[model samples]
Target chain A: MAKISVYRFLSAGCNGCDVEILECLVPRYKLADLGIEVVERPEEANVLILTGGVNVKGKEELLKTYETINPPKIVIAVGNCALTKEIFDKGYPMVGPPDQIIPVNYYVPGCPPRPQAIVKAVADILGVKIEEKEDYWLAPEGFRGKHEFDREKCMGCGTCAQVCTADAIDVIDGPDKRIVRVNYGHCSFCAVCQDECPTQAIRLTREYHLVTNNRQTTMVSNEVDLLSCSVCGGTFIPEKQIDWALKRITTEKVPAYSEFSNEILSAMKICMVCRRSIKNIREAKRLLTRLSEKVRGF
Target chain B: MPETVYIGPYRPQLVEPERFELLVEGNIIIDARLELGYMHRGIEKLFTTRTYAQNIALAERICGICSGIHTLCYAQTVERLMGIDVPERAKYLRCIYMELERLHSHYLWFGILAHSLHEHEAFLKIMGERERVQDLLEYLTGNRMNYLINTIGGVRRDITPEKAEKIRRTLKELKPLSDYIMSLLDDNGAFTKKTKGVGVLPRERALDVGAVGPTLRGSGIASDIRKEDPYAAYDKLDFQVIVERDGDVRAKALVRARETYESMKIIEQALDNLPPGDIVAKPGEPKVGEEVGRTEAPRGELVYYIRSNGTNIPERVKVRTPSYANNFAILEMLKGERLENARAVIESIDPCFACTDRVTIVDAKTGRRRIIALR
Candidate 1:
């Protein structure tokens, strides 16, 4: 029987992949139980398991290892970085895929592929198809293709807007009429916003349908009505989101009503333009007061 | 004449040196010269191009075992730059995940240490038990690995009452198993024989070399990032930093073993006092300045140096990983040790190759310089 040797390679990638690779080879998954052994040098290796994404500095060494390894050597590209350069491939100095940099026979995908998956990939490369029933215990329901926001369901309370990754969700129109718009392209479907939604308005449906024939249409936006003021009939948005804007527009400039009068407020159900006009009038009054005080001091 | 032992992927060849050297005598290795730069990846240079938000995910991929620590440090650094204050609840969550990561990382190291010592049964047993912790992490965070839980300002997810209950139940199951494992650490004679005094990294050497985490703790230098520089909710949690007096492989193992118990205690306390509030805090972009964020990773202290130019993208993102620093002490640890003890010694430091790949090696004898390979 030929002695089977394993060469675990990491290419300027995260150390977690290497640790997981070690996990696969160790007694937990026991790659050696099937007569596999980890060799220190690439020359003594029969199966080369390449972990991590190829960084600029590590590319030369990676190419050298691929060239040095003997023929009939099976290469397994493990983890998302190695398979597709996943997160790091955007603008990072990635050489290419593990197969592009070297001759790869098998590919396992995961942020860091589980030890079982890695072990399975190795076994498959060795021409030994180890059949194990797929465990469906932890699998989420549906063919969810990442996460997509139902713009209609979003309250635009800036809850999802606050936690969005793609900077996809933004609360425009100040806080009162704040709307959420998602850049679908930037969304990885991690569904963090959906999970953190206060009103349970943003939900990640199992529907994995996302299409982008044009860049302009990739962003999906939804507007929501803000909680209006009982007295002024104006949008009294969440205090938290509008604190920055409010700091610029002082309380004197903000339209106020005398004695919380709903009758006077009902007559002034005006849009933002009219509301700004009313606010300016209030500001002019405060400026007059300040000027009078200055004149008296003089 | 000393012969160079060439162990290549193609074939093994032994060639005599051009000069008659007294360094090598037959099979006995008088001096060993390591050849690195077989794998290199320019990850640091790449960070400059990525946005600060994007870099959090990117940094997490630097090392799988300590991905949580990497993301935590990155997030904390960005938060500091942005002048955002994380909620009390988020801090506790961060501590919980950090301790859980420490548990799994130490368990992983234990398995590796046992494997290197050829204690196959113990290795399998330790790893098989580690799956429980992984399950807990998976249950809390969506993914088992690369958990995108940490974000700028605060965490992305929150553990609810139901989830906390589940965690409590799981901890109950893990407690006895962990206690049993701790008992076995001292009782197992074979385990002691392989680790005891095999690799002795002195306390002063550990401090001078700037070793962090369990490696420094094992050397009796009580320098823990959690204790010294409290980040997340570590300051709130009640747990001791485990330290051992002897700077041997056994002491390192003992540090990790005791830390596992401490980690469990931290998780319990965090879950018990879990606060109810928003998990994330919304804040503006960071100002132009340099800020440092550090966390105690499973291996040691993982530090991230971030410089923001008042833009979404950072000007520079420099990571000083625990493994990267700890790996520097390897040559010193291996100086007087035999070739057979190399694997055990490496495992003792909980060497993280993913973290160590950033190191640039310069030859002392010659002016030749080489970068450590990732593979």
Candidate 2:
């Protein structure tokens, strides 16, 4: 293999991704052993490794650097910021994911991709084998990587979306179904979603190799059925959430709550607005009677 | 004729994007002016839009190398605003992580210095040691750079007994390597010759320029936030504040290198006296008020001023990173030095342009700004 020179451009986002790229040059990774050199100029380089997302000024600078590189050049966007702009996308000055401005050939995703992942990105593009130490940069036991969703365990309660550090999880409440989508591009791999999930429906699996050519395909989504209110006919809660709430009630030691479990389950079906509209005890009694009678038909 | 030389908006010497304009008469630099804000990402304005929990992640990204300290400072400030008392175990855990971060950061500085000095062998040795420190951090916190262990009321992670033991073993192994590196630095003629009398900042000028961290301490000032304010478990730990009187590039290097031992000692004490109990407190709702959280970051004093509006989100968050102060001192240090030593003096202060360049600077006389807004 000929000597491949790489020029790294540090853009506007945090410097975490650049630090990880430097890690590849350390003794363990031995980027020098692969006949790859980190050149000072883009003109001398065959590969351009860009870290961080570009801001307004950086976007202009990035384009100039891109034009300096010769043809037959490969551009690798490393880290979540470079791939999807991550948390900085909400900021005013940010104007990138790098691919929007220039044509990116490959994407290595992580808050900051591991050193081996970056080396793997370059090696994969050239179709070269990474010899020895197959488990060198393997994800550890508690490593936060790609988001994994369990459809059976999920109830679409949106707690993961609420606690997400990067606001990467989106809960779309449809008339019949609630769709919870986890966008890996915007994720920082903080695992706050997994920690706050009420049903343990989300997990950050130990699969850190998330590099891909397509940005749109880097998402995992789960859907659950939504139940409408009996009184107003408005979609309110997921059916699985109602079942989970009933299971919580049944596991309690109080016999009084369990004795009225049917009535409680029927009342849970009504949306808060309709239930609050009952002005008196007579109206509440009439609604409960009608709800119980309706519940029995099922 | 005095010529103007522009060093960068992009250069190999600087890690982040920053430019230096130098007025030089032949080989000597007469004056130096720094132009920054090229890497601004609007982090302070972004803080207002996110929830408190999300802000923790944002704070960590302010600077990647000293990430743990940023979160520690932010978390402590939020805790104060909410009037939450962190657990004893969490306090001690924070100290352990903070010192480990210092060791990692200082080693990284050494590696950069060595690389610029053309001591490739020393650079590799220091970076190898740094990698070990990062490996320990990764094993403990799951990430090498941005540990992400801090939360509003306490730490998100805990140090187990097995992990504590591993920390002790790693520090022990690192001691010999550090001593060998110190000897290499002391004996090498080329290393000492280039660094001995270069980039000299007198003690009075260092204080005048408002230098912080090792830059201030290297000039014989014993100012350290950990000693004066004592946030986290620093109050209970035993460690010395290393000081050097020379006020040169070598002085700052020596201060950082010697302080690594003090960091190791502090971590050992925190591990030995690790408290037993919960690692977190239930954070309460924010009461409307303003509070400041300050800590001794690896580079120097880091301050985060937070204003809460009786909600989950903060009304305002202002971060005063140590580099912001130390960067100004470079202008003073750069004066009257040879043009060749300019990069060394700048790197000596451990400038983090990403942390410093949060806003655009406009000259009062001309009323002009470098960055123009589009749309």
Candidate 3:
């Protein structure tokens, strides 16, 4: 059996992760029972456990420590910091994401991963396959993928942008050509944007699948426009929704409302006939009811 | 001869000049000199750039254990600056969260202190019971650590009657457990031996150094931010601030243990007298002005000074964390104590390294300056 040693490195990071790591070492989830030993020196350890992201001054020391450790050493980037650089990434002089600095063998993702997950990751890395059921309590709520906007449904209302605490949503194209753009990196999937959208245009898709070689592009979602009403010529419907239905049909690109001349506007559009018909039908129904009551009284 | 000692969260902690040259012929620490800053994150500098609303979130992230306290202070300071009134119900709800934070934080510190002192069984017992408070926090606020309930004017969530009932029942169940733990403090001779005479910070010295929370209360000073400043609905609720005259490790422990009981009682009272109304009031951004906000965190008084220049972003924000003040007394407490007792002496103050590491260190011998490291 190969001797495995783990050296946990934490620099200017929250102590909660370190405390939980200590708890894992205790009698309850004893890692020693599984041939894992925590060592004081990184050079002697077979596995390096990277905890906190590297802050300004700690960056050099972290790299130096990684260099001193022998080759064929497996690095396990633990927590959100080591994997994606959650909060600390925004801080000045940040040197986070172990993969950016060094090659990582495996990654355990979480604000602070549970002890069980850490244990499982370690077991899997050591060439042992262990199947475990997902814990629903640990799963994140709301959308984990890119944001989608239904353009046709959007009333050019900036409610989504206003309600977004993260400021990820932006109304880029002006009031006339209103287009909502979302920076997926800043979006926390809080669904505040979706809830605040007046027209029910913005929504979180159920797709959680994300993968990328570039960190910048990996987390962001691509934007798709909704389809508009052909008669009124309003791009109020999401482009995807219309495309899904009218993919087989031939449709010509209609001119924008501003582009239509007075002659073309009057000839091309039929204004509110359905709305007027509904109102007249309701009025006629009321008259007939009143007439029936008068005859009965006579 | 000046030896180097490493501090801060880094592995093989950064080595700093140690001016303390102890000539311990027997079992006494003859001399000690204070060394400062390896953990400074420039939080004050960073705050200058953040907006008033964004600053609230940033302030809360200062310390995970006392995140709620920081947010409360920040929100209050902004409200004061804007001259806006927080809803009556909001104040009561804030107090509930604040007290719950105190219960969990003190329990966490107790467990850590016990663990440092090598009382493994006691540490586990304390932490096991502490989870109930965390459970309450998770139930009340969505998250266990970062409870993002605070907004610019008031809180975001309201405590419904059904939720209040659940909180009351949990508090009732935990009351007996806290009492059982407190009983152990009286009979355990080992606990007394390790803490009673250790880390003695005299009342005058504590006051002179501007110690707050249990650190100050342990020194026989009846000073508490909740009592003195009376932010939120703390004034409405009837509760006594626990104090002890010993000014030692044991005194601090006793103050914390007693405060836990007082907190539970306050929670029970607040639950019964909870008012029915809106949890939050809509308010605009704060105009240009500076306002100081203070709140009693689990450790001590947390003060935030916010300055707005009539812009979306704040001109400057200065945070005086309780740990920053309480940590200054460490030099006085560690005097004439053994090296092994250093951890206990430090933990007794409930020093928040994240909060305290802001101070810059200047070398006495060379006048060279550097940040103090905290490990």
The runs of at least 3 residues in candidate 2 whose Cα sits more than 4 Å from the true structure, single-residue gaps closed, are A132-135, A231-234, A253-255, A272-298, B12-14, B187-190, B354-375
Q: What is the C-alpha DockQ of each candidate?
A: 0.17, 0.50, 0.11
Candidate 2's displacement at residue B313, Å, is 1.3
lDDT of 1 by residue, A1-298 (tens): 3777876666645555566666665455657767887765667777777766666656666777777666677777766566656555554467766667666666665555556656765665556765455442223332123345565445456877666543446567655565567654344345657767855666654332232213335455666666565445567564333332333333434334222233223323333454457665575466556545544753
RMSD of each: 10.0, 5.5, 9.8
lDDT of 2 by residue, A161-192 (tens): 99888878899998899999999888978888
lDDT of 3 by residue, A84-122 (tens): 555444666566656777777666654344454467667
Q: Note the clash tally of each candidate.
A: 20, 0, 22
Best by TM-score: 2
Task: Estimate the TM-score of every prediction.
Answer: 0.69, 0.92, 0.74
Q: Candidate 2 docking: what grade?
A: medium
For candidate 2, write residues B273-320 as lDDT tens digits. Answer: 998999999988888999998999999999999999998889999999
